[model samples]
Target: MRRRAVVAAAAVLTGGVAVLLGVAVPQAQAAEVSYATRCIPPSGIGLPPVDGTTKVEITAPAAAKVGDTVDVVWTFTQAASRNPDIIDLPADSVQPSGTLKAAGAQSADIAMRGPRQNPPVPKGGAMVLSAMKGSLKLTTAGQVMLTPDAYVVNALSTDTSCAPTQQVQPAATITVTAGSGSSSGGTGEPSHTGTPSHTPTKTTSPSPPASTSTSPSPSGGSGGQTDFTGKVVNVPYTCQSPIGQKRATSPVQINARKNGGSYDLTVQFKKSVMDSPIDIPANSVKPAMQVVLGGADKGSVAVEGPKNAAPIKQGAPIEIPDLTGVYKPGATGEATLSPGVLTIDALGTRTTCTPDSSTVSLTLDTTEQAGGASGATGGSGSSSSTAGGASTSGGLAETGAGDHATLKALGLVAGTAVLLGAAVFTYLPGRRRTR
Candidate 1:
């Protein structure tokens, strides 16, 4: 009897130590809930509202202490709905972002971002969205209920805001308690913080070997044509968008080859500078670059590339294809080339990016051909002129306080949907609330 008693005492002490060390904690079971949702299209677009069912499975920790940050994951299964228009949505284009309403111990809404859909969405086909993940820090100690809230789907640059039409059941619930004197071993930061937390990395592309050749000049004389290869330049750019100003470094590869009277220029972006916030339709994005010229030339030249052949999904890298243009030497000698401004046009919206500094990428030694062209012209069928000449044909979209206000309103709607879902689930028997 004494030996049994001693064993029991040892077991109790071991369990206590495990609790203090945050070991042997019970895992929270996932809970599934379904709710009716109504999505309203942007006003003045003359599109009717959409109604469907949304099923969500949420997983979270069963208990947490104050100041402890816990992970929350939500997987959504959207009801089948036909597309309203004939458009091609590229793979990973549909992105879902919304809020999770928290009640009881915490009243703040938690924002969530889901992964992009994998399959392409064809015209009049069913839409598929992916799973969402978020995190929250326990503040007040109590039972907190998390419910699905309003969400938004950005497809082909259009915002379709959605909410639950009926009462929503809570997807999960988390029990919060006072923090222990020791650390909880939790990450201090939340996963989703409204803005992206990615850092841009510098990248370079390999260059080709330099070569020299001769071509017949416009004046019937032999002109020396040289090819400058393997030039990589990194330019810092600031881009203005609906969200805010985003800064990144774009690595550019430049190659110049003298062809008779003019120099053939090719510029390629080694790395993408920004991510697309919404799905971009095929052939919707047109990219252009302004190349600064020196030495033999004094002004900048405009180069244009073809429209994107495939659809660009939301959150994916926005890539600009190779830009080609022709530059005619004005005075001869050695000419210098550098990257300047970059412009992107999506649908009707224009995004202009200005480089902080122009780094010289290529230089070519040449003799001016008689009766050669004077300014720069696009090689790929794009109309362009010098810096002091006619501007590119495109109007900038209006953006300001209105865009910010719209985003806030959408967030509130998402929060409300979450709260309603939680309240409905509380009344159902055998259904536990989740956060």
Candidate 2:
């Protein structure tokens, strides 16, 4: 009886430690970083003080429900002094945009544009640049996993004419409160099938602290058993640049996977760092970037058990293991995640990629059609319907691999403790009886 009691106590203690490490490490250590854009006015030493003030006001519904189509708009009123060629605010950085239709109040002098022809936006919309007031509208109609999130819309000025730019002080704040309705198109409480307490909040604000509360489930993947093969991710980029189409770099395939099942997927990925020059049109007043990330890496993410699937109900975050970031110089003279890693938005070219093993090969196929260059100078203006590549700061929260290893080490310690207790209990009592 005493031996049995001893074994039981140790087992409980070890199990407790195992569970605690698994829960606490990931929840506490995962980087809760948020990134955003800050515009800077030009500072000239010898030239005239070309002071420009660009004020932005966001008009959005205080709260929105999933499935309900709504319009979230941004109104930009540029001061008379500044002639900004491109004003960028990432739509996803602001809120959970569904069918967003962002537009800039049509302008005669400045046309909306980006560094790459196609900027990254989940919901399709064009960010435009006009001299006066321009607007951007996005929708969160069908997305279900939204929660109460505060958005910080950073104002960015990327003009060849703005010569030198600096960070805008006191960034604007916007709140998007997630409410539950219809499982279909109505709003309701956030589903909590053990979903993360802190949702993705990078670029604008630090993610909320995760609940220390634990809710463990049995060893079984969630329902909706689906097997996806060759889940190739396609990260959105210009695919072709505006100024130099032929000079455009190729798309780097950072990661790829083939789902064995929901939780049992096999993945191959790489993480490399590189520095390249930012693109600038010849006629545009802006100069090329000083340095940008340019390189490739090897190795991918590691997956733990109990996986979930798409349209994942019950509120758990869709964690794509092995999260990483691609650092680059921002439009406003700052370093930010050009293509943030491990985010639902950065989930990559989720549109069923080209089937193949591990290898990235593609040319800079210039999608640069005939269009007017944006600057303070003269040119014929043309409009396109794609998201321009002028990136405003944005980011995604991620739990690093080191955190995962710590949890595993704790589990191993617990398992060893349990075994040691059982062995000692059996041998010591038996030896006493024999003596």
Candidate 3:
């Protein structure tokens, strides 16, 4: 009886400890942070600020223990700006102990257009510059996991051009009060709570897996999906003039898929600008304007003249140079399992006098499925459609490889955690008896 009692007690204690630790082990230790920044502007700084309003929103983790560092990031957008240029903000520095919920760092950049573009230059549209800005604060309980050495914040553009840039003063410490870590009955500010009561904010907003709606079933491969019937239109531009025109010829085809099952789909596209030198001759003025149009995702147009040059009267002729021969051409699209919609926009610039290309826009009709095999397995499938008074169909849509790989990895991580948890609960008590 005593032996049984001893075993029982041991089992209960072991289970209790395991459960507590298990809860703690996965109870994400993170830091919650928030901040707001504004540009001190004189309106024109020679570098020509992005021709419109800009805004940024940052949501850090809620809290961390003593030594576990969490990642911090900033997401910025050019709210209603015409010129999809860059905006600069302060970087994060080493926080004084106790000043931060976690000891990681902070960072950011001009948002890049997409994964396809490396050293991702800002697509002229708002995009996440850096996946992670800097290191984070964390608990020193077991192994002290420190944050990265440095974070990359961005620099502000001058009124004249984006080439010559200026860096802003970065902030080092994250402010936290004593009783603020918890989501409720707490100050809502993040703080270090030694016990396992903190939840780490997901590093970098949880961007949905870049899935497509073109596939038949949610499980099929990228190629076995339907292609949208549409022509690619090029936005025209002109150097040194405000008047421009657009061509309805040389249309490109669009292909896509829907994740999950929904009707509203979002679109994304890449944008690039031409590097040209302006020749408005100092003091001489022409009503030069920048116009961005198309789609429900993001669009804007701005007209700015040289400082001291005569202001461009509304409805004035804005010359736009033709870009008939530029830009790569192809029918690109994908299929998604998650279902829903996503709209992506990109930006580029023209150095001298030229028109920026109209970003490729894809409206993923998330509600339709062409065949029997739902592209759910990430396998192959097929799609059928009617284009130009004829039957059109497609196969083998490659879900952007980078996107596919990332989603697969995330699934593996989650599965491993579940297995580990089941083992701990199922085997620990039996082993305690033998001990």
Best by lDDT: 1
Per residue, candidate 2 scores C-alpha lDDT tens digits across 1-435 of 999999999999988999988733211111111222222222211123232333433334433443333333333332213211111223222111111122221101111221222233222223323211122222223222111111111112112122113333222222223345333323222222211123321121112222122121111112432322222232322111111111111122222121221122223222211110111111111001101111221112222212122222212222223322211111111111112111111111110111111222111111111231112111111111111223221111112332111111111111111111111111111122121
For candidate 2, the 10 contiguous residues with the lowest summed lDDT are 406-415
Best by TM-score: 1
Q: Of 1 and 3, which scores higher on lDDT?
A: 1
> In candidate 2, which residue ranges exceed 4 Å CA deviation?
1-53, 56-74, 78-151, 154-315, 319-435
Stretches of model 3 off by over 4 angstroms after superposition: 1-23, 29-36, 40-128, 136-435
TM for every model, in the order presented, reads 0.42, 0.17, 0.21
lDDT tens string, model 1, 8-83?
9999999999989988775785898899877765443324465667788888898888877788887776542444
lDDT scores in order: 0.57, 0.21, 0.23
At residue 234, what lDDT does model 2 achieve?
Answer: 26
RMSD of each candidate? 16.0, 33.8, 26.3
